[model samples]
Target: MDFEQGSINISDDVLKEIAFRSFIEVLAPDEKDVKKLKKSIEIERTPDDNVIVYVRTVAPYGQSLVEFGKKIMKNISENIQRMTELQVSAVNVTITDVVEKIETTEEEE
Candidate 1:
């Protein structure tokens, strides 16, 4: 897009940050675990100027990964498009690991 002044260009890092923040918002992972998710997001620009997003992360063992992935994709796509006005061709989510949700049991005093 162009204005009277000049054209606005959005950087890949900004795009990635938008997607990353969206992912974090939807996933709601533990604060400490957020670092683990930071490096897994990537943004690609297609020849046609469209965007493709790749996300890899771990999910809780009992959750439905397919549904979770779909949720992630939807959030990421919507966020990038809404924020940057970039056409998102796809948002691919890969579940890299599954960790069991730990349960804490209280001891009777």
Candidate 2:
């Protein structure tokens, strides 16, 4: 009896896609109707195949910046490693902007 192991190789674009999906899932889950705030993201790799992902995102104002940052890092690193089965060296998250949550102005009857 013979058994074979299969492997999957993803391109750089795939890496970017995965990183974006992961970020949006954790960070921008509520931004479905609205376009994704993350304008740019990338997955960098070392010569030895180590993975490093960078994400630039927008955050809602009046939130805990420290906690938010931690969540982004964890989500990106874990999601990528979980989905791709690759050793993620690190996940660097950058908050490019903070948009104030607009209050709904309903007219009084």
TM-score against native, each model: 0.86, 0.73
Highest-scoring model, lDDT: 1
What lDDT score goes with residue 58 in model 1? 71
What are the root-mean-square deviations of the candidates from the true structure over C-alphas?
7.2, 7.7
Task: List clashing residue pairs in candidate 1.
Answer: none
Write the residue-wise lDDT of candidate 2 on 82-106 in tens digits. 8877788988877766668522112
Highest TM-score model number: 1
Deviation of model 2 at 8, angstroms: 2.9
Stretches of candidate 2 off by over 4 Å are: 1-7, 29-39, 102-109
* Per-residue lDDT over 28-55 for candidate 1, one digit per residue giving the tens place of the 0 to 100 score: 8767666666678889999978999998
Q: What is the lDDT of residue 99 in candidate 1?
A: 69
